[model samples]
Target chain A: MIPKLNIVPFVSVDNMMKLVLSIGVERFLTELAEVVEEDFRRWESFDKTPRLAAHSPEGVIELMPTSDGTAYGFKYVNGHPKNSRTGRQTVAAFGVLADVGNGYPVLLTEMTILTALRTAATSAVAAKHLAPRGARTMAIIGNGAQAEFQALAFKSLLGIDKLRLYDIDASASQKCRRNLAGFGLDVTICGSVEEAVQGAEIVTTVTADKQYATILTDNLVGSGIHINAVGGDCPGKTELHADILRRADIFVEYPPQTRIEGEIQQLAPDHPVTELWQVITGQIPGRRDPRQITLFDSVGFATEDFSALRYVHSKVTGTAFFEELDMVADPDEPRDLFGMLLRAAA
Target chain B: MIPKLNIVPFVSVDNMMKLVLSIGVERFLTELAEVVEEDFRRWESFDKTPRLAAHSPEGVIELMPTSDGTAYGFKYVNGHPKNSRTGRQTVAAFGVLADVGNGYPVLLTEMTILTALRTAATSAVAAKHLAPRGARTMAIIGNGAQAEFQALAFKSLLGIDKLRLYDIDASASQKCRRNLAGFGLDVTICGSVEEAVQGAEIVTTVTADKQYATILTDNLVGSGIHINAVGGDCPGKTELHADILRRADIFVEYPPQTRIEGEIQQLAPDHPVTELWQVITGQIPGRRDPRQITLFDSVGFATEDFSALRYVHSKVTGTAFFEELDMVADPDEPRDLFGMLLRAAA
Candidate 1:
């Protein structure tokens, strides 16, 4: 079909998978990481706000919106931990990218897979700055849906060739290992969190409980190791112990939001933390010393989603991975919308 | 094709026009007015918030969100008055309705046509309680895209048969007069706003300027006339003179929002105004006397959009007015999202 002004390109779940597999997931993550870093370098131009969330007894739904003056983007995402038990994905998402000039959407895409890729890309980008030099081994606790993506992103971006996976459910760890078997990674399924973190240079904790459970205690964390904390994203959901948070130099994306939703929520309200953008722009030092522990509080921000959507929009330009959706109303004479309807009747 | 678990029903602009024309615009407005009134009766059960707006030099884009404990709905809309000159709709919108329990969107729809229908339906519902008894003649100022819808709604719900229309641009008024010719309404194109309001029991100011333009001055508004102010919907954008507002008992959709966006912005911060919901629920009288000038300062509320989306969701069930959209990802095993990608490669 010929594209029209009222038509927005839509990336469905099936087409999104085709896009990822066609581009190759590792190459996509590596390229997306470069885009994420580019946006972080110019982060001051963005209009930022904390994600608007509506909490419920079962789960929470959120709208994350941001604009860079020319383009506006927002993601509609939900996190329901109990959904997995009922044959549903624990997290599901979709997003829209629109023109700020005319307020018409240009692209709409399923973001469940896009979000997974962006989160892992963001983690790898932060690790590129904060992880110890020549880091080779990485341990990921809570090997659920996001585990393989994180492992692949590290392998592509930082040359991390060894993976130590651990989960409370052994099948989850086995699934992670099986998924990574052909990816040239030395994968190991550890029986305990202690065994998972034993000689690893980086530790990623991404559990899926909506409570104040301490997946990483202070005793489990050692100096000179970088920690990626991904699951402590809402008000009452946290994954790290307060002792580990107090000891580590916490790096966050948008402190106003991370203060309420990230690992720093366990710290004092006035506790000092450095923004990751400053580190990306070289305004602040990333890893001060080899013995210092760096923790990236990854609650996921709007700009990261904006960067991912922007990347997808560019890649889908000449590709058939998206279908045109007749979304906005376009009247020949703007003031004659009623006349347009009347003509449609005829 | 059978609907999958992740498929969401999408109503496009073409489908929306078909649905509206299928239902007959007058009957649709009357039924939607009933739904709007029913939702207003239980206003306290909703989680309401002022729209999250991103303002720029061009115009503004906003996300208006609300939830009724069981369902959540939001509209993404834009207002750029200059867009009409470039052959674009000055106001364009779309919305989504989701299940609050799992935070999954059940419907996605083009809401530009839906917004016009809902705004007209809401005004008629409010005027049903506020306008004088046996009101027949209505005047519409600024005959733009919404004018025809407003005219038909009053005709269907309030027994209005005579319309005196005025616009700064004469061609717009002529277009409005032409659109309503076959709708069984006696329509006249007036030369000025004063002539339009002459001998009219209800006057609606629906101009589209983004600045403070007084379409209705103090002398233009007479006693026993209900003023439906529809165009002064943003900060620094209003349609009435302060003198006219001072002499009128203003009613608003939501006080906090209307105080910033409605004509009431010209009034004092503590200016007393009644909530329209209270009047609809009979907690307060709508019009105390025939000589009282009742002003409905409508900036449009999220709950109105929520009610409109709910109404559309009900009307489109099992109808050909919608298509199934594969927007959400559903993995067979929720934790094996990455494995699902791997299998897709096969």
Candidate 2:
């Protein structure tokens, strides 16, 4: 008989999708945002470090690990911008949550979908704290895999019901428009970044490109808008012009990491930036005035992934959304690992 | 239908044991040693780094990652010495091997068994280079979970047919003696570490303790013996006395890592040590003199794990020792990841 300790609850892509749909994407985003906010409120309790990255010509792979004294979590993610040409995701990920007391993994799940959910939820949380008051319109400047999720998250979390979408590839915007159809939001497919950001209170730049291509130019971004900079997450991959970063009060998740991978990578190492946790914990003010531009230089952090895993672990109980994976070796006698192997032959 | 890209080959604990048994433990160790030696020979071609460790009051969890430009691999391992009291293995591990070209994981396997195999094989490989001419007897000071594999590896790889086993817990030594009863070797269960090391050419210290407990004192370690120090693998955890280390010419895998986590951790940071790869690659001499003591301070390296994964990947090609897991999400249109989740609801 297989030992219960050896069985890790594995959430596959299908099961994750089912779980999201069952809870409804809006509700999932709201709940995930709350979890992320709770973790942010207690940020000093986590063991934080810059992610370990292995870069290649095509892309990079990274392992992000963090523990909150009780549970340890890590996400294995790869980003290959060129993967889309071969019908593969530009980003794919999986993560594990383990018990810190015994150093045993309790949950193993596909994080590609969860990452999407958490990224959007994190954007919504930031917008709630920093966006201009009574903001109702968001300009999604890159209508790709993350566009609709960001749209729904903003709509659900902050009551933003209008979206202005634009992508260099027109079909991507059409796809986003089609996906968000009848979701109780007005989605306009724009042709240019200028048109997308026109009269918008929130501008999200989430384009998929390996190079430092400016999806939003300095002149295009106006005052008082909360800029969610998502695509500038790796070295040499910024989506906004440097001038825009210079003009905005940057709020980031983990300054050490954001300074390397976020839009602030273009700035000096000692450039002043506020940690988002400080804003969430009320240690610092988010927006000083309605005319002040607040940029959440969002380069997804490990704590958000930890919170996502925590949320999934809580929701997956008494549900069939996960399968048991026999990943660990369990012997009746701890020292009899060899004997267990020998006995299995019989 | 599930996409081909989504299916990652998974080798469970049971399958790993079966594969090891089918190949015969002796042959497996020999082959694994060869793979490790080959990787060591070409060490300059691979990326290397110190393992990232998260330490707690109980134990530690670490992530060891390395890449050979073409393929990337990492192992997730934990060492909790107190876990044995709860009928759990002191160490547990799992690993993933991914393609660098596309950043897709090709294999995910239970590394608890493979780690045991590779560690023993690595010891044998080191012994092959550093041990005295025609060394026939090995004194194993800790007859625990790793003892049998270490004994068999030495016996098979270096033609060491005699064994002397000792442990503070006599049942463990008795268990080792009983396990290797019919394996074509003379096994003696000794009462003390001094008795075990009597007349033996090689001494292996592999006890599982979280603290700096000396299992081998300097008085017992005579000249001309090759010591394989395996248990002192983390900070503040060592098996050999500082005097023993001072008396021996230490060789290590990745000096930066060994200086922090190996037996040499007791020595100064600038203490001279030889890289094992140099010896394997014929860049440096091994077993310099008959009277000189050589110690292989093995803290386990990522490249060795890479070689183990490579070896398993080669052998499991046409075998049913693995199951395909739906770990990666493959969308019909890669940019439509949110659409994939939305369509799943319908």
Candidate 3:
């Protein structure tokens, strides 16, 4: 007899870490960046919607869902800034990828680690399209949990060999510098944001505060720098001053979403910003001159989660990194659901 | 040392079935109805929104989410009419209940069985308030998977001792009749809808078709009858004649949702309807007079699922029916997510 189709592949946190290590972090970032870019190039074929978020006093819980013609995916993620004070991670996530034909989940994976990897990879993909040629150094303004991933992703994708890190808490920069040791990059712990971005070609801001605070003022930023802004992802959360946005040629993942959640939320709703997909698809130009500043204001869309899930599903197939979860109910007879439950008792 | 708070309790299909049987199916339905009613009584406290649906040519996939101050819950469900031809269920579901304080999932369970139970319980709860006093006989117009559960819910909740069943396919009626045997209720398989509704105080039409096919007409439904319409729950899909809807005193779960997906989708958008929760809370009268026609047009809602998850969470706290799933990633240092990945490799 054939086995029932009730089993769904599940990737636990340990399994996800193993998968990442087995594939090698740099190689994984490069490959994931390719997948994300590929999805972005064909962005018109997707069913897009802004994430559905439920906000509370502490944080927000969101459901990000999207579908291509054949597959559907969604992620359940939460951002609680106060969680770190209580020994918990500020962000936690999990996602599901399902077949559109059968409406059954094919893969369920923990996405906290994957989200970090994908966010960094997404930033790298945008930088590859918009950053200046032969850029050798990057300044990360907020050296928090995402800082290391951003540093490594830029190294793997763009060959950046130097890093400058700064944070409001100097211990965070020290921890980031210690984590990046032996990663084949010269790391500098700067006392202030202005010192961090002094000579760097790329500037990444990834702070974790839930409030609207300026981590980078306009006068501190120089010309010809590509800004990969990743931290300002919810309402009232931003990192850059409005002057920087006014002077830069801004690009975003999805304009409607970015207007609400990205750093661009500080600007007017009708602010003219190019879509990053347009730049990737050659529908719009990314960088016109070396002196022009380009900002990739990413708010993390559903399609990226979909792409990451598809990539993970491809790698984990027929591998030990995933286990079969009996999540879907498959009865012997289609209409005999009650009978199936009765038989289980006997 | 305190155990990490990363473990989420998961209830599998087998465990859910075992839970239902252990509690006794009738008692389970009765108690679940009570829980649902209790939530309905406090409907003002819930965060309400229409279900987020992604429609496809074949079917629809939906995410239904709601929160009640302290806890949040969401259900992922799909409905496909063509699935039955391939020996798959027409509907499959699963859900998660999480903490509002920390935004961490507490319980993950298969909701296909639970949806069946809750759907039935919701119908019975409506019937208890809307059906004529001492309603003894019920006519179930669709004898499918849900028919038996609806029969039992009515039996346990309202003491409905006699059931008149009818279906387009005689085999479905036979299946329902066979499954409902020895449940201490008189079940009769009728040849037609009119025959089934003969001398019945309550009429339930639950045929599953993806079109606007009317199973009940104006003249066929008489005075002083309570109609529980469950199958008309999607756009372009309804089971009642517009004439009958015009004549009945319509009660609905959520007007915003029911107006688009319930039997009243045939009526005007601004057509006045009574919310079921108002009746449950005693803020509005139910069954205003003996000769009045009352219709409980339930399309299901997120709060009912929230109540069900809350009910399941309450029952399975110390029981072996649930297993711990290492679904969340907890790093020793929340900022060292990469370090957590690195240590897992060794």
Best by lDDT: 1
Q: List per-prediction Cα lDDT, in the order shown.
A: 0.93, 0.92, 0.91
TM-score of 1: 0.99
Error of 1 at B335 (Å): 1.2
State the lDDT of candidate 3 residue by residue for A160-194, as single tens digits.
Answer: 99999999999888888887887899999988888
Greater lDDT among 2 and 3 belongs to 2
Scanning candidate 2 chain B in windows of ten residues, the lowest lDDT window is B1-10
Candidates' chain B TM-scores in the order shown: 0.98, 0.98, 0.98
Interface RMSD of predicted model 3: 1.0
Model 2: per-residue Cα lDDT over B1-346, one tens digit each: 1249888888999999989988998999999999999999999999999999999998888999999999999999999999989877789999999988788899999998889999999999999999998999999988888999999999999999999999999999988888887789999889899999999999999999889998999999899999999999999999999999999998999999999999989999999999999999889998999999999999999999999999998888789999888888888999999899878878
**Residues A1-346, candidate 1, lDDT per residue (tens digit)?**
2356689999999999999999999999999999999999999999999999988888988999999999999999999999888777889999999889988889899999999999999999999999999999999999999999999999999999999999999999999999899899999989999999999999999999999989998999999999999989999899999999888898999999999998888888899999999999999999989999999999999999999999999998899999898898988999888898898899
Model 2, docking class:
high
Model 3's CAPRI class is medium
Model 3 DockQ vs. reference: 0.73
Model 3: residues with Cα > 4 Å off, grouped in runs = A1-3, B1-3
